[model samples]
Target: MGEFNLPVKQGYGENQKTSCIKCVLWGKVAEAYAPNIKKGDLLVVSGEFYVEEWVSDSGKRLQPTIIVNQIQLAKKSGDKQGQAAPTQPKATEPPVDFDNDLNIPF
Candidate 1:
């Protein structure tokens, strides 16, 4: 599995709040798309949402997570509707080593 942080914005003006959601992608989807995702790139994702709860030295913690089933690059603000986002060139080597376990501190 591969995971990334997605920033979400809600409400407007004075009431606006921004949150960072943890998204997890598994198997083929992670291998195919994870390498191409970059910071500042807008993405559309569909998945199951839930809160993962755990306890740490500090205290109990809750993390909102998404199990991404489908994901796609979203069109830029200047692009016309129905137009696809530009694709990045395929890399000769994988950008991340997914075979090893990630050292994520929970």
Candidate 2:
């Protein structure tokens, strides 16, 4: 497993604040995606989210973590000149057809 800190921004104007979350990527996903990630690159990620608690000299510490299941590169913000988006790693397996798999009707 590989771990990284992802900073997330929320709200707007005076209410805006940035928080960092610890993300954990395991196995194939980490191997295929980690090398290609850059500081300014935008990404779309999905996974399990949870909080982990631990004790420290200061006291108990709580951290939010994500166990990334899927990740894809996204176009950088303000790229109005139509630059091509970053190439993504080829899928190791066929994508799940959620509708069919869950038997949900359109």
lDDT of 1 by residue, 1-106 (tens): 7899999999999999999999997766577778878898888776768899999999999999987666767767767665667544354433333335333233
Please tell me which predicted candidate would have the highest TM-score against the true structure.
2
Steric collisions counted per model:
0, 0
TM-score result, candidate 2: 0.73
lDDT of 1: 0.74
Model 1 stretches with alpha carbons more than 4 Å out: 79-106
Cα lDDT tens digits, model 2, 1-106, are 5778888999999999999888777656666677767787777777768899999999999999877766777776577856647655566543333333333221
Q: What's the lDDT for all of these models?
A: 0.74, 0.70
